[model samples]
Target: MRVASEMGGVGGTTVMLAQETGLARLVEALEGTAREIDVTFARAGSQLGEGLGLFEGLKERLTTLSTDLSGPEIARAGTTLSGLAGELRAINDGLLQETGVLQQLAAHSKDASQVLERLLEHMRLITILARSARIEAVSVQAAGRDFGDFTSEIVALTTQAQRTIQNCARDHDHLSALLGSALEAQRDFEGRYGQALSALAAKLEQTLVEVTGRQQRSVALTSDAATHSGKIAMAAGGAIIALQSGDSIRQQLEHAIKALRLLAAVTAGTGEGAALDAEARTAAGIVLRRLEAAQLEESARSLAQDADSIEAALALLAGDTAGLLDLVRSLYQGDGGRSGSFLADLEADLAEASDLLAKCDRARAGVDRVTSAMSTVLDTCQQTVAALAGTVSSIVLIGMNAGLRAARIGTGGRSLVVIAQELKFAADQVAADAAQLTPTFAQMQETSVGLKSGGRLDAAHFAALDQAMSESLAALRQTGDRLAATLDQLTREGGGFASVVAQARLSFSNAGAMSDLIASGAAELERSVAEAAMPDDPAAAAAAAQLIERQVWPNYTMVGERTIHQAIVGALLPAQAGAAAPVVVAAPAQDEADDFLF
Candidate 1:
């Protein structure tokens, strides 16, 4: 009876020792797992919070970008490049018209050059006739004085003609040069602007399209990120709640440990050779059976269930954390060097187009200067030619007088009269050439008027547009930088969060494993206790069970533990129901539909 009372089974002494060691190990594992749960969850919560902060930074930056001029309005402003291109096309057309005028003027210049050549030839003939008349005077010595007077007047007229022709030639050459310069300037403007107009027009149009598309994509991406952030926040909340619930599992494990310790105390008794009495052993057996049946099984099941919840919650956290990371990466793909900055690129293209337009203006100004100077030169040449024609007429009158005077003089002076006739013919030719030159000059002057530009674009309008667009692009670039920074922060924080959540999930699994080992070991000990021999004295056992329940009641912190103890104590010591009564003032609802213990 004493041997049965000692360990409560045949050779139960050895079995009890083994189970005591197993219980110690189980308790150690449970303690470690519970402690690890706290640490892992703390880290998980902290990391998740940091990720949330990073996402908030993104939201704030996005809001600022939308509020500032850097947003879609900048794209709208950039679209004005197409209008500028239109203006450029118009300006280019004006240059083309003026170029046609210069070309026409070039044809008129050719005609005037021919007329000037004829006039120069007639002046040379007049000069030659004056020399010939002088030679005739030398041949006819009697008429030498008369011929000398005529030749001298002829010489003066020829000298004046030479001067007038030289001046007209110089003026024509200068006008021709002006025409060339204007044409050349127009060609340059046309070549550069034609290509630029096409390219800038196309590029600006394409850029506007791309910007609009990006704006739409940005809106969608921003919405997605916001939704993902909310999900992450929700997942983090669930994980934190699940982590908090793990504490209750720890409490349950603590109850199991306390029960095991009480079992040890009952078996160990108060001192050496002071083993527990027979009824006390029975009480210990009953306590083990009830603990395994109610508390250990429930604790084990709760552990499994709570651990799964923790794993699932943390797993969701990990998934969403990774999703957030990807979202951030997608947001900043512009920084990734694949797509490049949008507004900055548009700004560069705008600058190029602006520069082309400015060059076109500069070329137009150069043409204007050429045309003005050419008109002045054409007017001066016409006046000189008119004066030359009058001088040729005076020479013709003098030549006629010389011829008549020589004819009156006699046969010896007849040769001088012939020379005078030749001189008159040359003078008439000069008058004809001068008359042709007049119409040519007038025609050239009319064409020079056509060289004036049709009109010009308002330079100030474009200047202001460029300035506004530049400011908008700069602001947009700044916003893009801030967005990139936010994405980078999100990536870093989210990566850390993923790692922490994974670890937390792993820790929950580890705790579950420990709880399983504890439950299995507890089951073995409960069976050992149940199989242990009991004392024949039922009354002492009942009284001892009641005393044990009252003693260990303080160890039951959870209401479930108290309720389990209450039911078991009432059954084990039924007669003392009034004494044990209900430890719980209110019979709280049982959780055996039995997932989580409150």
Candidate 2:
């Protein structure tokens, strides 16, 4: 009877120890899971912070960009650009008119040049007549003694006339050169300069329209991004709150696990079987209640919801960022080859226009040169005509004197009189030719004056137009570059924010999975505790205890606690009651509150 009683005591102690060990293992598992959850929650919080930081930074930049776009400066710039475009169009129209005028002037100059060429031919004829007169005078020198001086005076006048004719020919050549240059310039203006100006004006108009549209889009996108950022921040805040809640739940679980371990230790140390049983039953009930009320499943669900919210917010932000990227890209891309980018096209067009304007200026200068040369020709012609008039009067007076002298000298004087009359006729022809040239000279002078004035006006317009185009294009390029850079930064930040959100999402998923696993383990522990509390025969109880110690406890044993299995097995199958009580090997010392299962 004593032996049976001792055996019962040994069995009871073994069962109690087994229960305590199992509870220790369950507590350690719970503690380890709680620690893992806490760490995951912390990491998730950090990721959320990183995501929120990126979002806030991006929001600030976008807001600033939007503000700049809507500011008075941008409005003024747009207005200035519009005004410049209008001015360019007006200038282009004026240029077209000026080009037409230049064409007309070139044609008129050509006609005038033809007239001058005719006049030059007539002057050459006069030179030839003068040379013939000089030769005749030299040949007829011996025909009359008194006619020699008169003939010499006639020869001097003819030589002077020939020199004047030569001067007129030189002036005509110079004028013709000037006119040719002016004509070439006008042709270039018509073909290249005019077309470039028109194209630039059209491009500016298109650019202004596109820029205005992009500005509006940027404003709208920025507003939307800001709004979305607020949503994202709210979502991150929620996730942070959820993570904080999870951390609190983890702490609660740790405390509950510590309490369970303490209960197990108390149950194991107690010597009375009934008290140990009652304590074990109480511990099981407490653990079951705690497990039911722990609300870990709720935390997991909340975390999942928070993760979903973050992902959704991130998606919206990504969409907005993509839209902004598209807007930036559209600002610079062009339609075809050679027109590589809008800025590049504008720069090239402006450069070509500037060169064209310079050419126009040079052409105008050529017109001025032509005017100077024509004026010189007119003056020379006037002087020559005046000299010829004087020369003709001298010849006529000399011819009349020779005739009088001839009448005195009789037959010898008769030949001299005929020569004098012929000289008079030649002088009359020269005078008439000079008279005709006067009107031609006046007409040429007037035409040249008109051309000079018109050219000056055209040059002024070109200068103003060129300046306006350069300024407008430069400002537009600068603004566009700045906007593109801002958009690029926003895009990069958006990507970084998305990455952070992704990491947070992954962390949340892992934490949720871990939480679910812990919850399941808690449920299983509760079921095991309930099963252990049921009434069973000694053999069955021992079997149950052995099964739990060997199977369940080994699975949850703390790291570096390999001897726990031997301790548990030895406790379960102690030596026969009289066989030194199997040395009752004690369990390894463990600070259950601080220990972990994994």
Candidate 3:
């Protein structure tokens, strides 16, 4: 029985061991699956992180660009607006630069304009020479050869003047292009940079306000202590000592107040009517009034020299009050004295003014803080402008160097003459190009002006284009989806799927091609319209003669005309399976002898 028990136990142990091994295998499989899932999740997270990094980079780039453009836009707008005195100084700088360029151009124009003047003078001289030739029948002694030579010389001179005029025109065009590019770049820079600077300034102003608030509390506490000390000294009947103590206290309080005022001026939200400034002034005023009205003869005698302290406080308060009143007057566009009853209503007026002043000062200080921050941004913009100006200067110098080669050409030399001719030809081409570009520039200017003023046509056109595009795309997508659903239905049902697929494919292919054509043609159409009213190409004129020669005369005048009857006949001819025969119409005759031509 013991042997049997051992065998059973061993069997049970083997079974248990086998079960444990199976469980371990299952656990290993589950762990492998879990690890795979973890790896997948980790890969997805990494991909997301990379995408976010790219998005952040794009956002930073856009922000920087927006800032650069905004500054120039604001600068330009501020100059245009008389109310923005803040930007007047900046605007003046831009004006100075523009004026400098204009002065240079005007000077250059004076010299180059002489070419036209010379051309006219030479023409007059040629006319005189032509008249002299007409006056004489034959060779006029020694002057005949001279006249011929003079004519040739004058012609050459005239050609040189023409070439010079052409050069001047080319230069003018180049200058115009440079100026346009510069202005556009400047405007873009100003718009972006100004917005960024303004935002930064606002943030700085907020920071200043928090700093100033803490400082105000310190001043208030010091002034209160001085008041308490004076009150205690007066109660003790040591009038002389009390007055001397108060005098010292007042001076200390004044110094503290002044320090607070200086801090308030520097802080954001602490401007013309800052609460701190108003509170300081009010405290000083109260102390002065009480000291002046007090009946302390002994104290007065001892502190007689200290009277200046009280007077100083009063003066400071008065100055602040005057300043507050002036600010109010400026806002309302009126004189405070003209109100006539301001002093009579002093307490109410003072209280209201003090509150207003505090608010104004805070607001003004905030604006100042913002402006200061903006100045830094403007400095950066100026640096960028300087860089751009350098690039423009380089471009101008390169173009000028190219122009200088034409100036060295001598009249008699064939190579030099050809060079001069080519230069003049190139200059004429430049004039033509300018003439072509001027209308486009004018149109762009008009469009910009319209945008600024909010014109109706632009709004209407944009709205129409947007609506049309959206509607068309929606319709196309809906049709395609419907066709796809139809094909899916045909396939599932196993009924005529092949025919339906072929029809749908053909329809979509045609629709897509049409859509592409229309989209591509839109720009081409606009260009064609703009060019339609301009001069025709000389090359195309050659084709016109050929086309004219290919024309065939019809035996009947009616052959070219296609009326409703003709259309009906043509439509019926295929159905009838007959050759199309021209229908002849008889013309109305004034007389029976007139031959029929139709």
Candidate 4:
């Protein structure tokens, strides 16, 4: 038993190791694949960089070679030709001088002339020989240089040709070897192909058996699927009917609520419409009770639509608050108590409504917009299908007509058969498109009617808000104008008061300085007068001092002169009943006047 237990444990461990090994190998393979992908990308990047660098280098080398070899060679040859022409001209001049000397020697007859003639002939011959030798030497030198250049070029060409021949021979040998290898490979491949074909035939036989079995299974599956699909379609139809019914009920409830709310508002506005008001309230209560009952019993699907309607109504009511406030103000004639009471209650109610609407609005709008967009899209699809059908029908009719004419005309009737078949196919396609579009359009039309009705309700609600906003904007404009006028008046009055204060302060400061100057001058004059001797009798002196026919006043006046004159005028002037009193300044008393002397 112990041996068997150990064996079993070993077996279990071996199995676990095998499983772990398999998992490890799977992970390694995945890692290897990822590494290979990264390596491939890196290699591609390197190759692309290398290719670009090589292209740029090659371009630069080719441009340099073209300039250095072809263009410079032509320019050098032209310079060489110019030098050769100058040498030829010098040779021609030497020949012409030699010819003239030979003519002069031939014209003499004495022994000296005969000797001169022989000498001139020798000179002419020497000159001709020298010129010929010079020309021949230059030609030989040029030929040697040309031969050397040609030899160098020939050697270079020969070297290139040898390399090309070697390469061609190597390539030819390689091609022969490759051809032999290919023949051997082809023989091997033919043998493998026979084996492969035999295996493929066997696999085909097996596959056909499997396919036949699969087809049988598919047939059974298809039948079962058809049955299940029929059941599912029935369920879907029932669900759609239930959904639509729920939607209808929800719509009715929303309509009833809207009517009741409107009636409530109207009744509240009226002072005495008791019987009609009672009837309206009774009808509203009945409708409200029915709606509330329906809401409790209805499916969750209708709640979305109800939520949407509630939200829109709340938004409209909130937007109309400013209008309501204005109407209340008009009724109360700006009485704070009445306005405050009405506004507080109204705002509280509106706030509650707004909160409730916020809750339902998001859900409602989402569903409605989705439904609306779907209907719009479906309608557009129908239109597109109809247009496509029209085009296809026209094409089919034209093709059919053309085919029929070709069939009547002659030998091309065989080709026209294909055209006829295509035309028939096109007609079938158009008919199928129309069939599909008809039901889609009908459904879209029905959905569109629902959308239009809902849209009208939403528009009406928003229209009230639009009107209220317009009124608010107008009131704001008037308030802005009034505030602007008040600001302007305040600014102008502030400026004027500031100017008056500044002038008063300046005048007061000037007066203080003038008073100080005058007091000092008067004290000095008093000392000088007292120090002067009085002339004889007191009465005569006093009479002489007092009697003045004309007195010249200085440009500067005493500080108290204006003050004194103002005081005297104020005292003598009669007071007008409605006019304001004038200000007066009192003169300083005796002690106060004496104190200024210091």
- Most accurate candidate by TM-score: 1
**lDDT at 508, model 2:** 55
Error of 4 at 191 (Å): 73
lDDT (Cα, tens digit) per residue for candidate 1, span 128-196: 888888788766665355456667778887898888898888888877787778788878878867677
Worst 10 residues of 4 by lDDT: 547-556
Query: Superposing all C-alpha atoms, what RMSD in Å does each candidate have to the true structure?
Result: 6.3, 11.7, 57.0, 59.4
Better of 2 and 3 by lDDT: 2
Against the hidden true structure, what lDDT does model 1 obtain?
Answer: 0.67
Which residue segments of model 1 deviate by more than 4 Å? 1-10, 46-58, 69-107, 130-158, 178-197, 212-226, 266-343, 350-369, 385-451, 454-598
lDDT (CA) for every model shown? 0.67, 0.56, 0.31, 0.33
Q: Candidate 3 — worst ten consecutive residues by lDDT sum?
A: 547-556
Judging by TM-score, tell me the better candidate of 1 and 2: 1
Badly placed stretches (over 4 Å) of model 4 are 1-350, 359-386, 406-412, 454-456, 459-598
- Candidate 4, residues 347-466: lDDT per residue as tens digits? 232333333223323323432343344444444444544554554455455446645644564553434434444444634543563455455345434534533453232334434433
Pitting candidate 1 against candidate 2, the one with the higher lDDT is 1
lDDT of 3 by residue, 468-539 (tens): 434433443443344334323322322232222233223223222322332222232233223222113322
lDDT of 2 by residue, 276-311 (tens): 343333432333333332333443454456445545
